[model samples]
Target chain A: MAAPPHFTGSLGYPPSSPSPRSHLHCLSPCNRAIKVSMSQNQSYWTCVTQKIEDQLKQLIPVRPPLLVYEPMHHLVFTARRTMAPALCVATCELVGGQQPISPNQALVVASALHLVQAALFTHEQLPLTDRPIPSNPETLTHHHAFAAGVELLTGDGILSFVYELLGRSDDPAGGNSERLLRVIIEIARAMGSEGMVDGQYRKMLCSVLGSEELCDVGWVDHVCEKKEGRLYACGAACGAILGGGSEEEIEKLRNYGLYVGKIHGLMLYYHNNRTGGEEKGFTDLVERCTSLALKELEGFNQGMVQTLSSLVRASFWDKC
Target chain B: MAAPPHFTGSLGYPPSSPSPRSHLHCLSPCNRAIKVSMSQNQSYWTCVTQKIEDQLKQLIPVRPPLLVYEPMHHLVFTARRTMAPALCVATCELVGGQQPISPNQALVVASALHLVQAALFTHEQLPLTDRPIPSNPETLTHHHAFAAGVELLTGDGILSFVYELLGRSDDPAGGNSERLLRVIIEIARAMGSEGMVDGQYRKMLCSVLGSEELCDVGWVDHVCEKKEGRLYACGAACGAILGGGSEEEIEKLRNYGLYVGKIHGLMLYYHNNRTGGEEKGFTDLVERCTSLALKELEGFNQGMVQTLSSLVRASFWDKC
Candidate 1:
């Protein structure tokens, strides 16, 4: 239960093991790997994150109305991490950079992807149920309505902006209209009903209807696959797709993303929550997915592959 | 205060005048025109609505975990009207239909737009503030969380599907990658911060901070133009863009859409809530926008232009 010896503040995990309700820590092996990886790839992650942030800053226009943009600013700048965008840039570079659109253009698309994700995060935080009116209901009402309107619509705004980014074809990498359109469609599919949204819906039902009766591995895995796995997979696939990876290469990166997400989901949320899966089963899934992801990087740039492989492997080094 | 003479159930307006707090009824002149227009174009409106509905029925996939899709089904099937999609189709037809993508393709995009709008509508209904728990708080909590999750994500699901349709390039009209991308981008711009989302944000601020002083014509008009006008304009513009209308033609259709939306916004919400604008001022704005919309159709197919002009005119025949 004690914290990993090397785990530090920058990792953002708790000092000790994740508590029953806590859902943001990795295993010690994975935890330690992140610490080392963070130090090693400090510049890489920082640069990737910064690039996305900078591009979004420029791309998201500044109109007279500040209300709409403020929440968006908070959401983008203050997110937990730029993992999706990072994965995108890393994958784009790995795919040999053969596409007409540059990695920078991929990041622009990634920024829009992050915007959609940020919108989801914002909406998720809204009070699900109605609360009792406080003594000062007026202030509460105004704040709630205002914040809700801003956050909800901000997501929609960013979503529209995603298409705008592609439409304008402002890619410094020049124009790859066909490829850009393909990437847009792929991201959409991954996020649509059968993908991330489906995952969220399944997760909800499992919690409500399934309860203790069905808190089994299958349910957890299903929820994780749809919710987290799909988005990450989509992000990785998008990077490869936009980078002009071959179909085989795109599939590999997508699998890598799915596995990375799955591993994260298991470590992050299902550790204390699991009811049926053995520790070995969990570790096995992680091993399987990790290997699968690494396999996808075969034949890509050696440095890029190593970075991505390390990124994926570092998360599961505990049991490995 | 009485319902317009020709007005009936199909208009979807109230039989009597809107209450002080109510904001759904159109002005009597506009209302009467709609009734007469409804009778005149009963077939047109019905056909347009049915086309969108039928296409949507096919486009929105049905899968397992019925819970996730249920809300989407309800939202799409039970919308107030198919006006947005109707505009997209109408404009597509009006633009001479020379583009490779079919009218059906435009509908596919319009359906996506409607999905985003539906998502906005669904989210808007969620309580911004958490309400006091009722007697059975557990049931309330579960229901609230479940409903919130479903509604919030359903919007996202539909938004994603919109891109999928376009990405698949299933445009039976053939292929026009450049134009399609352009249309996609234009739609994004219309829905983003400077467009619908900004309008919604401004409207919220007005309600909260500008309740008294800022509740004038300018405020209402600004909100209407952004929230309502921009969307219709986007829809019409998409139709023209996809239909291969010239830049001038596309611009004209877009303007026409903006004007239609402006008139609707005036009659729909401001009739009972305005403070600065007189009835005369309201009439003038309607006249201006309507004339502008009609003028845009100067060289289009006579029949299509007349249909659109009539559609725009039907809302303002109060003076007639």
Candidate 2:
């Protein structure tokens, strides 16, 4: 099959919000933070995303095995904004030590992370039943049994691809295979059962158990750590691992990732709840996570970490 | 969750066959060949399977994260017979060089391959429609939405776990990381889009497109090469690569794997067709793959490759 015509080189963001919420609702409180952040450092994030997309375009195959590769290429290259890849790149720069991994390798890992998130996004949005109408029309079409199958398998394929890329070069970045292997294992562990998948399973249970139980703030926080926080944190941690950060530095960056991840999750939760007139300790939780994230970076060079600090500040606080 | 009482160490194989055909149908002409081979080397194949299972039981986790880990453990540890892992171990021994890869490391890689196959098997059998009554009641239950989610994510999680295991050791088998990295890449490439997933996508399309079109022998053959052949080829190829096999030995084992894999796929295809009164060049195809596989092993010591030769001969020619 010939490649799709619209599959041009330019990074045109798809016209859809990837969040689980499906509403024509007004700007979420989270978006208000984004609006302010964008106004202040719109160009910065734009350049970051643009660079990632350019690298991604070069990385993915543009031709056949269109069924598998196209889904992944479109998912990664066409997305408007992706925090995971951005966080990875930013953290890489923050922790750039005596000998850092190449920017190309960093982008390759980031892009793979993005593909995992995209796969989960697609899987989650698949219609629970093979019905005529789906809740989210944009994410998946229930018209074919194979569409879900492709998405599911493609997701599995990309997960394997992440390792394939990691093990791509010999003595990559002049680092031994053992170090790279450690990095690969670390990332996989974070994304595996105890991390992202666990959180997802918990959330699924909460939804089935219904709203009365969903309001258990502790459970929400727990899920937040797993579902959103772990991946975000993982993105930054991967960057640190590849950047040749010292053990202390890696730990610091990981803590920073965990806090920032929590902030992101809380903001998303706040936004979803705001529309439903549900409120909790949203601001308090956000404040705590933001402060914790900031504290982790205090010992590091402020100049190199500014973009990440700014990104987190803009994601949570009204002012940077 | 408490471990199931049936989680005994014994290798009482699951009652179900891994084939797509759901009906209680007799085997096609393929088993006539199996009957002859099994009759001759019945004790040999049984011992190989038993040894693999003993190692598998020790390899899998026996405790918590029951939802995620249990599915994987059960799938891998319980299956009666699998060609992937068997081919891996067999090929490793066949290519025993001066300083062969340690048996522990070979088992590690073999187990990972088994996990990938099990994951794919689980995902393929998942209900396409989330209705109460599925075509195959044995595979999945129609309970919580989380059930499918868990199965899908568990499949994905195991895929990650495969890589995680590869990178688990610091100096695996006293071999440098470079060789292990190569083995990991080879396996990933075989399982990725171009290999297993590609064939799976084709089969899904055929099912969705159901007609005489599904019987288009060329497309079916192409799918067979991908879905079944690559993984088996990958398994043996990985063994040869890791065992310090020379280039010629590696190529021979790979060809042997491809042929055996095709023979296996053909058997399943033939069995699935018998109830439908459909037939193709089943006997001819089996004869050709079997002969080609045996030819690849011709140069090796007769005693060294007896199990493999017997496997091929039994799988096709009837008498060992």
In terms of TM-score, the best-performing candidate is: 2
Error of 2 at B125 (Å): 1.4
lDDT of 2 at A162: 70
Classified by CAPRI criteria, candidate 2 counts as acceptable
- Cα miss at B35, model 1 (Å)? 19
RMSD of each: 10.2, 11.7
Interface RMSD of 2: 2.8
Which ten contiguous residues of candidate 2 chain B have the minimum total lDDT?
Answer: B17-26
Q: How does residue A251 of candidate 1 score in lDDT?
A: 90
TM-score of each: 0.78, 0.79
Model 2, runs deviating above 4 Å: A1-45, A77-81, A97-101, A130-146, A169-175, A275-280, A316-320, B1-48, B77-81, B97-101, B130-146, B170-175, B275-280, B316-320
lDDT of 1 at A2: 21
Candidate 2: the clashing residue pairs are: none
Give the top-scoring candidate (lDDT).
1
* iRMS per model in Å: 3.1, 2.8
Writing each residue's lDDT as its tens digit, candidate 1 over A13-116 gives: 33342222211121133334455434434435555666677788886645445666666676655543436667877677676664444666777777877876
Cα displacement (Å) at residue A265, model 2: 2.0
lDDT of 2 by residue, B208-283 (tens): 6666656565676777778678988988888787777888998899888888777777656554443333343555
